[model samples]
Target: MVTVSLPTPVQPEFDTTIHRRKTRPVPVGTVTIGGGHPVVVQSMINEDTLDVDGSVAGIRRLHEIGCEIVRVTVPSMAHAKALADIKQKLESTYQRVPLVADVHHNGMKIALEVAKHVDKVRINPGLYVFEKPDAQREGYSDQEFADIGDKIRETLEPLVVSLRDQGKSMRIGVNHGSLSERMLFTYGDTPEGMVQSALEFIKICESLDFRNLVVSMKASRVPVMLAAYRLMVKRMDELGMDYPLHLGVTEAGDGEYGRIKSTAGIATLLADGIGDTIRVSLTEAPEKEIPVCYSILQALGLRKTMVEYVACPSCGRTLFNLEDVLHEVREATKHLTGLDIAVMGCIVNGPGEMADADYGYVGKQAGYIALYRGREEIKRVPEADGVQELINLIKADGRWVDP
Candidate 1:
């Protein structure tokens, strides 16, 4: 009998890092997504594109606070033309900011016009080549489906060629709520429908020799959103497509639940190494979304833009008020970027638990706290001075920076 060699089983202990999916680099202004670049953060301004002054200020505010790419809606030809003034004003007053124009619903002319003013253009697959809903229709015949596909190709070609010639990129954004009538009839309201929707547009762009594409599959419900993106990645892998992805949960509402909901979907895919850029869509000010996006990236160790605090939950053995000390420590060290600081409740688990931190504060006894520099006990200071002492230790080690 011939012997068969078995594949090696995975050792999870050695698999500590997230290996991002391989994607070709797609440029958006000066920033590049995928191709092993640090995951990019993006947000959209709510200002109307026609309000040139307001739009310029809005884009500048978001970009100043670490939003790499900003998108503005272009619902009409007037709004599309305004992007030229907005782009010029941004350069003259502020700095050159990467802008994307969102076009929808028979928007070919608007897209071609706005393509001249922005670094990238985003088109919805379901709406770009609008197919008026037929109330009398049962389902599309195979011939009718092919007919619509041809119409889409004819409409999309000019915009594709314009962006390709300019070396700009395009986002084939597919929303679950807006699947085309034909796509819905063909694949039903499901993740398969979403994947097929993006794939059709991608193939069209590929045929035109335009590959600077980013794809998004967004749904209001987290489960549907998650399934759509995962399915898209699987389909792209099989087809040898290396386009980057833009991750978000559409209509993620406002307040605590919104942040949690967006995080649950975006972070889950990010952990699996699926997304190259992300936007945390919230109903609050556009500025509010930037911090949430950075927080998600930081928590995953994908990008370190802020100080990392590792604090233990208080137990009966906790010496001092763990909550109060943690707050104080955080306030002092929050500006120290790329540093990991730990605050522990007591000695029982403090040193052992915080072994990986750059610096740690542990309660050693009543009215006293011990400081650590990577598992080595530095000194014990009075609890009242613990926060200041931690700051001093960080400064002594040359890691402190003024806020």
Candidate 2:
């Protein structure tokens, strides 16, 4: 039976079940994702991988920002050949961040060459070396569909064998925008079609006893992305396959819109305990995507990278400058990570809302502030003294570490 090699056990520092999914772990280089490991963060380089200097610099910046797994596009044979240099420069000078070679259309040959260099390989199986079949235009006879299946088995078996022998991992990444003609004709570009597109190759890998796999079903639309992932997990369960999932919403455009769209889709499944690793597909710079990935993980309580602040929208009930105080407190305490700080406008719902907070700053009177640790009131201090008091409270409680 194919099984996972789980990571060494670590004590749970917080309640992780809120977004924790149970799956067998897959190792990509030194990082172990799934099977109760931390939700790993990943991002891809926007540069040409064949431009070794530019790609290496981009990977260096991404590594500095906490990107655990970095993927570089290998669109053709030249890029595949570039992988050796990219891997060498990264290992010799920079940190050994796991490199994932992302390939399309000509994935079989490219993946074979790139796999020998990178730690993991990701291919959109829906279009990997697949051509639009005559069935799409002329309609399929049963034999034509069978022929397509045979082609997939032939093309993919060699790559799977190569990956298995190298002990490298592979991602059967399926995007809703790129389903094969065979899938669109049969399932009509729906989530079912996307899931079926992935399952076709997944079955092939399992048949060869290849189990170092991760699966993804990505889409630009939130509804489709969410539905496809939920359905994929159900399908995996039925097949007794516990491969970790890589979650993302593709072509999620730039700026605040990109962050919001990506977060909503990624966080939805995470809250239900479905995803194991994530990439925020913003059209922004690759390094920018890393923080967004970490923010989503931290917000879901799956990973905590920095201080978490909770604040209220100011109203007539508020006695202080709600926005300003919140901002000032954040500026002062942002350096302290894994700490929950609440800044509320007034006492009405302030204490109740921050019931679980490590420290709180809530408006108590027209110009005074109430401080708290848990639900217990620490003191009532003047408005001018609130920020300093909160800092001192953290220090007194021994939760403050020099930043």
- Compared with the true structure, all predictions reach lDDT values of 0.94, 0.89
In the predicted model 2, the residue pairs found to clash are none
What is the TM-score of each predicted model, taking all chains together?
0.96, 0.91
- Candidate with best TM-score: 1
Best by lDDT: 1
Across residues 1-403, which tens digit of lDDT does each residue of candidate 1 receive?
9999999987678676898999999999999989999999999999988899999999999999999999999999999999999999999998999889999999999999999999999999999988899999999999999999999999999999999999999999999999999999999999999999999999999999999999999999999999999999999999999999999999999999999999999999999999999999999999999999999999999999998889899999999988988888888878779999999998898998899999999987999989999989999999998888888998898988898
Alpha-carbon shift of residue 214 in model 1 (angstroms):
0.3
Model 1 per-residue lDDT at 309: 88
Question: Which pairs clash in the backbone of model 1?
Answer: none
Error of 1 at 36 (Å): 0.7
TM-score of 1: 0.96
lDDT of 1 at 242: 92
